[model samples]
Target: MTFKPLLQHFKEMKHYFIVVVLVFGVSFYLGWANSEQFSHFLKDQLEGLKSLSQSLSNKDNPQMWFFFIIFLNNAVKSVAIIFLGLPLGILPLFMLVANGMILGYVLSLQTHESTLSIVLKGILPHGIIEIPVILLACAYGLKLGMLVWKSAAQIFVPVANRTASAELKKVLTLTKPLIVIIVVLLLLAAIIESTLTYWLVHL
Candidate 1:
């Protein structure tokens, strides 16, 4: 069997990826510009994160703990969005917007710090890979959502002829393998974030 590069196939759905980026960007801007409006929401979220961090901060192996936490968190959420997106893609969109907004809100709170410095010193090291992986997951999730919508339409109205099955067949060819790829990439990102990013941020 002749194998085609996944990149080439991914291009077939560039529109989904583009939409993901745009939605994330807009949500991020809103989070940054109107952070005051979301202060309570952000605080509640951060408290939960802080609790999780405290629970997981095993002194015996800090780096390993970081890796385990980051990887597991990203991997589970990333994979969940894809399948969870089946409901008209709402969950994926919500996740992306929420995640982006959370990031922006956090950065906005760091007003006394140089944002560029913080991003370069902290985020850029791993975000280069991590952020893209997440966006890609959200993109796939959005596509799955659309497919479900089409499927329903076809079921209720035969003339609607959405061909969701045929569309999904193409996607399925990549979905399983693609998830493995996402996991591997997120693993790499986790490693970088745990070690390299930690060093960079501390240094």
Candidate 2:
């Protein structure tokens, strides 16, 4: 499938992307600043992720299973954020904050030099691709949330069923392709994470 339109769409939503990034950055700073205080809390809140990271790190043959687990986790998370944005986008924003908090907390556990090493070796391989995909998903989710709000506002006015249906169709038409692209990108990211990132970090 052609990704030109999808890329263009993401470019158009630059404001949403910036907002999501800023929110993540703010939360990340908070987590980093209070690393000691937040460490236990983050560990408790992200037990599953901790377990998964441990499993991935400890495994010798982490190829197939690693790919499967990471892919499923990311796919579910991305889909959840996008769909849950239906509630005026609050859920997506929360998801972004949660992610930033987790990242910052985890990174803060290391010394500055170690943190740089970890990011360069452990995260950057797949992160280069994965991060942008996530931002795009968040942007689309926010857009969907705004659409939901607009549709809700339309309820107060008299709108024809046919017109609403057409509008919905237009939305679906735009959303479906974007979802496909996100899924594809996530799949590639999972592959890179399981293979290249796994190797680099272990080395």
Q: Which candidate wins on TM-score?
A: 1
lDDT of 1 at 162: 62
What are the per-residue Cα lDDT tens digits for candidate 1 across 96-198?
8888888888789776658888888889989999999999999988898898788777888867456797887777567777788889999999999999988
The sequence of per-residue lDDT tens digits that candidate 2 reaches over residues 1-203 is 56576667666678898998898899899788887777777888779876877787677876878898988888888867887787888988887878788888878888987999999987888888887777767776787787777777778877665354455455556777777877888899999988888788878
Residue 90 lDDT (model 2): 90
Q: Return the TM-score for candidate 2, rounded to 2 decimals.
A: 0.85
Global Cα lDDT for candidate 2: 0.79
Could you tally the backbone clashes for each prediction? 0, 0
Against the correct fold, how does model 1 do in TM-score?
Answer: 0.91
